[model samples]
Target: MAGTIQRHPVSPVSALRLFFVAGWRSNLALFRWMRPSAFIPTLIGVPALQLIFFVHLGRYLDTQPVSYYALGNALHACAMAGLFAPAMSLAGERFAGTLPALLATPANRTLMFAGRTVTAVLVGCSSTVVMLILGSVLTDFRLPAEGIVPISAAILVTAASCSAFGLLVGAAGLRTREAILLGNLVLYLMLLVCGINIPRESLPDGLRLIGEIMPMTHGIAAARQAFTGSGPVTGLLLVELGKGLSFLVLAVLTLRFLERGSRRAASLDEV
Candidate 1:
């Protein structure tokens, strides 16, 4: 009798059902939160300063399509920070004991993570749009309808991968405080090094290798091609596709495993 207990069987989430999980809800909340925050100004603020700075120093590097950099940075603003936002937010949520409450619900851990990742990508993309509008209005930069669909698709996929990477960070924090520090460090570093401000073309050979590992590199490469129409689109899109899916796959397998470990270690509710 002690071992034998009556229990209600729970239903497995259908593929469609997984789409509506807490992760997505959390992602939406992030978007809603952005409205009140200075989302637009925050995104374009530095870049606006950049445009002015460059304009003043006119003869600097007209070689590269500086106009193209504006749109590229829009994608950067959208896809860049995402590599770390999920993990950083998760760390905060775990520390605040919010994760336990969310996990206790029927919403699976992976789904919750997925939703947050999507939210991060959305925020990035939204920020880019804001920047794009501002840049278009203020400057003569123009983006085409042809590039729009591919760029959007690329950003979405990059978001999924970064979300997975974030989960990796969150899980690492479950092990030690050092993980949080490292996670935050790399997150910011990725923002700078992964061809966000400086172009991949400009980075030293060593750092260029590091850039290749970043999801942003692949996505930006595709998006850049989409913007310029100078090179073959297929190859860039293929690279972007591989990186995005690789991250998603890794995030799903790794986070779910880490979720189990975190629960067993009693770290889930600890913060």
Candidate 2:
């Protein structure tokens, strides 16, 4: 009995059930403990400032600077929320002594992680919408009426991609502090290379290549097209969705590798 592992059958319905219950509780706990002043600044203020500063600078050079910076920074805000918050939450679980119990449970860790992503996506989307509204008011930018559905789809894809990348970051954080640092580095790199402020075409060949693979690059492009009603929204949104799902698969593999390598009775320590 002591050495035996009690494996429960994997059920899709049960997994969904677990995800909803645990995910909601986790989000509530996060909000309850984090102070409003500190949380608001990180979630909204920092990204808003970035939006304003870039838009102001772009005004001098581009005729449609408002459109570029407004949408770009909105996606950037979503990326920050989706990428950092979830990773930090997972890392917090480790420090809080919940990681071992969580891993030991019969529930699938990957599904649990996905469940947590629900909140990440919601928060990311909410942040983007707030920025878009605020930017429109202050900068005289107008949201496209025709492409509302496409824009919404684009936001969801962006959130999905960033959250998938966050899973990788969270998994890595289980091992070292350097992983969280790496997440920060990736965020800034996205801004530079992912056409957040500068066009991907002008990023030099090497950086341009990097931007193509970054999560928000295609998503931002799709969002922009949706905003301007300029390009084929379905194709771009689908591509962005594909990228996000691919990252999620990679994160799953990474998590599986870490779990497999975990030692007996010291499983969490090994991870």
Candidate 3:
């Protein structure tokens, strides 16, 4: 029994089972690790920047809307946080050979993915709430007492969307360092094009149209309308909710396709 153990290659279903076990355990590790790394920045730096940019230096800018930027910044932090947290963690696992071992196990892929996605959502929301409380305490931002609920929904939805996309990118580009770079670059472009820092109306007509398609476009606008408005929350809720789910579904499908292809080509453990 001790002689060189010939490992029976795992079937697709067995591999998926292993993946779920590893993914969940990995997610818990992520939960513990990301607190100081990702959460701290989302809690302090990003939200403080929002307060500083709007409250301190916002008036001097040309027609820059503070109320709009507040919630925009919040969405920005959620997006950035999702990108920074789960993707980086996945990359680390890939480097450590955890992913191939995971795929070789017997866990369900859907359960595996759900655990990772849920981790991203929960962590993203926790950090977002800290940002919200910071905004309320440090700035003139006025939100509905019940506003926390919708904002949280938006944050979790957005985080799931981003994390799913990250998983796709991470899996597909495991060999290249471009995954993180590309994600952050896309995030930066989204920040600019999505009318977060500046109104879409201020952009050229063609650019304005492009901005509308970005997830950040709908996410930021919807979040802003909810954060500083005395009006109905239904519209913003619908926009963020619907669009966020769409992005998440698309991203998950991308992950599913990419994972199958990736496994067909090579396992994560192979050089």
Residue pair clashes in candidate 3: 14-105, 16-107, 17-106, 17-107, 17-108, 18-105, 18-106, 18-107
Clashes of 3: 8
Lowest summed lDDT across 10 adjacent residues in model 1 is found at: 2-11
The TM-score that candidate 3 achieves is: 0.75
Which structure among the candidates has the greatest lDDT? Answer: 2
Query: Candidate 2 regions off by >4 Å?
Result: 1-4, 10-12, 30-35, 264-271
C-alpha root-mean-square deviation, candidate 1: 4.2
**In candidate 1, which residue pairs get closer than 3 Å at backbone N, Cα or C atoms, i.e. clash?**
23-112, 23-115, 24-115, 78-124, 94-271, 95-271
Give the Å error, residue 271, model 3. Answer: 7.3
lDDT of 1 by residue, 15-54 (tens): 3356555556654443345474655454457556654454
Q: Rank the candidates by lDDT, best first.
A: 2, 1, 3
lDDT of 3 at 60: 65
CA RMSD per model (angstroms): 4.2, 2.2, 5.5
lDDT of 2 by residue, 15-131 (tens): 888877787677667555257777689888998898888888888778556789888998889988788766876776776677777777777777787777778888899999888
Which of 1 and 2 is the better model by lDDT?
Answer: 2
Task: Note the Cα lDDT for every prediction shown.
Answer: 0.62, 0.80, 0.62
User: Which pairs clash (backbone N, Cα, C closer than 3 Å) in model 2?
Assistant: none
- Each model's TM-score? 0.75, 0.92, 0.75
